[model samples]
Target: MTTICVDVMGADKEPAVLLEGVAQALAADTDLEVLVAGAAEFVEPFAASHDRARALVTTEVITMSEHPAQAVRAKKDASIVRAAAAVRAGEADGLFSAGSTGAVLTAATFGVGRLKGIKRPALSLPFPGISGRPTVFLDMGANADVRPDVIVQFAQMGRAYARAVLGVAEPRVGLLCNGSEETKGSEMALAYHEALAAADCGFAGNAEGTDILAGTFDVIVADGFTGNVALKSIEGTGKFVLKRLKAAMGASLKNKIGMALLAGSLKSLAGELSGDEYGGAVLLGLRAPVLKGHGATSARAVCQGTLAAVRVVRAGLTEKIADACELSA
Candidate 1:
């Protein structure tokens, strides 16, 4: 059975709401077991009611405002900290948390540990694209600054993610830059371009911001700073477009008729764009998969995130990543 340690605290939503998601996940995946970590009051009752779930009582909770490294160090009994320890100690195959991104990353990196030879673990998420396939993008917010060699490994990690999770065979990789031209971008991008082109991983060349969702590449790698900015920009632009569309649709009775006809398509598009589809971002290059959902995630998102973690464990994602890194080494 695939067991995932779920940290049910630290999210904006109530623990009960996240527990509802755990219940949903358990109902959906009969082969899955969950180690729900949280305060005694919150987890005990829920675990008692669920057959596949067991409670790991935790006393402390990591707040979003606290320094991630310091909080992890001070709060040994914190829910997220304990959850990571469970994964490290073989009590769980993976971990899922909708908590502070920094806390989850810090705890998982230090507690669950990085895979041998991995310089850094990257935060990766599958971006839904126009081509009916999701593009695996990495370094979403792991390392703000990275060297060319690190970027190359990010490319390899992204490729492994695309293949293992997205089921893409021979996934093409791209370096995100200001322009598609080989000569465009800062010295770092140029260095990345040179390294990726020479690396054994599939190198599809430089990808512009537009190519992120244009279905031009299966995987895109960037320094965490740039990747995080690009991700937020895409999300902001999507929201802006949707808001404008809603306004336009409500502007006139004629538009209402048009909206009625397009309602199904629009809903489908919204679902695809919603970050909930993939549950959350996976921290790649770690010894075990660590998924971090949005801080304000809903129960449905939590359920999806739990299932996504299960998928990662079942696919032997970390093993594949280790092999890829070793081969490249």
Candidate 2:
């Protein structure tokens, strides 16, 4: 059985909505055990309503609205910290949280630590590109700035993520830059581009923001600042398109017919492309896989994120990342 710890105190909706996800997951997978970290009394009612939720949940609720670090340090009972402890104690295979991004990151970093030789871990996001090919972008928001050597490590880790998660044979890596020209943008990007090329990597040269949407490379490497911008842009675009499509469908009789005929396909396609649907962004270059879901996640999103965590661990992503980094104890 796969065990997962969920931060119930995290997210905008609190434990109620989160319990829905836990219930849904438990009902779907008998082999899944959920460790809920929140107020146990609040969760008991929800658990009682569902048979599987009652049977599968191992109640362990942490308090709400406390500073994550201090709470983790002082309370030792905060939901996010307890979840991390669950992972550290080998009681849970992975931890999922939609809580304070800072708190979750801090607690996990302190509890799990980074893989050896990794300066700091990065968050890697995989976007479905043109032709359904997935491209990975790294350092989404872990560290705002990075050194040239760290950028190289990001590239290697991003490539490994693509290979394991996306099943690419030899993922092509590209440095995200302002322009494809060699002498474009800041000294940081140009210097890092040169470093990536020099390293023993399948560097595909430089790629611009435009190329990312056009599916230019298998992996996109950038510092957290630029990478976060690119990730938000893609997410914003998806939302805009979906909204416009819905409005168009409601405007006319012909459009209604078109929607009726294509609704199933559209739903499936949307499910495949959504960030929430794809589960969560992973904090890569760590000893264990850590998935960070949206703060406003739904039960479906949580379930998906848990499934993604299971797949990442089962695929041996951590070992592959350590091998790619060539770290020595």
Candidate 3:
């Protein structure tokens, strides 16, 4: 059986909501078990009700505003910290949390540990594609600054994720930059371009912001700073477009008739665009797979995130990543 340690605290939503997600996950997978960590009021009842779930009964809660490393050090019984410990101790194969991103990353990196030879772990997510399959993007917010060599490793990691999770054979990799030209980037981007070109990993040259969702590249790598900015920009733009569309659809009776005709297709598109469908971001290059859901994630998102973690553990994602890194090295 694949067991995942779930941190049920530190999210914007109530603990009950996350618990409901956990219940949903349990109902979905018979081979899955969960070690839920949270306050006694929340976790005790959950564990008592679900035969597959066990409560860790954490006393402390880490808030989003606290310093990640420091809070992790001080709050030994914090939900996220204990959840990571469970993974490290072999009590769980992976971890899932809708907590502070920084706290989850810090705890998982330091507690669960990085894979051997991995210089830094990356935060990656598979983004829904426009015309083709979802593209795997990495360094979402792990390392704000990285060397050219690290960027190359990101390419290898991204490629491995594309194959293992997204089921892409021979995924093409790209470095995010201002322009598509090899000559069109900052010194770091140029260095990355040169390094990736020489690396064994699939290198498809530079990708612009417009190419992120254009189905032009299977994997895109960037430093955390740039990747985070680009991710937020895409999210914001999507929301903006969605709001405008809603307004336009409700503007006139003629538009309402048109909307009724396209309602089914629109709902399908919304599901694809919603981050919930993909679960959450996975921290690659770790000893075990660790996923972080959005702070305001819904119960469906949590359930999906738990299932995603299960898939990662069952696929032996960490072992595949280690082999990928070793081969590249």
Estimate the lDDT of model 2: 0.76
User: Which portions of model 3 show Cα errors greater than 4 Å?
Assistant: 256-271, 327-329
Per-model lDDT? 0.92, 0.76, 0.90
What local lDDT score does residue 324 receive in model 1, on the 0 to 100 scale?
A: 82
Instruction: Write down the RMSD of all candidates, one decimal each.
Output: 1.9, 3.5, 2.0
| Candidate 3, 1-329: lDDT as tens digits | 99999999999999999999999999999999999999999999999999899999999999989999899999999999999988999999999999999999999999899888899899998888787678888899899999989998899999988888888889999999999988999988998999999998899999998878877899999999899999888888877877787788889999878878887877666555555678899999989999999887789889999999999888878877887888432
TM per candidate:
0.95, 0.85, 0.94
lDDT of 2 at 165: 83
Quote model 2's TM-score: 0.85
Q: Alpha carbon lDDT of residue 76, candidate 1?
A: 95
Tens-digit lDDT track of model 2 for 1-329: 77777776658776778777877777777777766667766556765675534322334433336565675677556667767777888877777787777777877887766888888799877766776677787878888899888999998888889888889989999889988987886989988988888997678888888767566799888999998888778768767887888899989999889888988977766655556656778888766778888877788888788777777877788888888888862
Ranking by lDDT: 1, 3, 2
Worst 10 residues of 2 by lDDT: 54-63
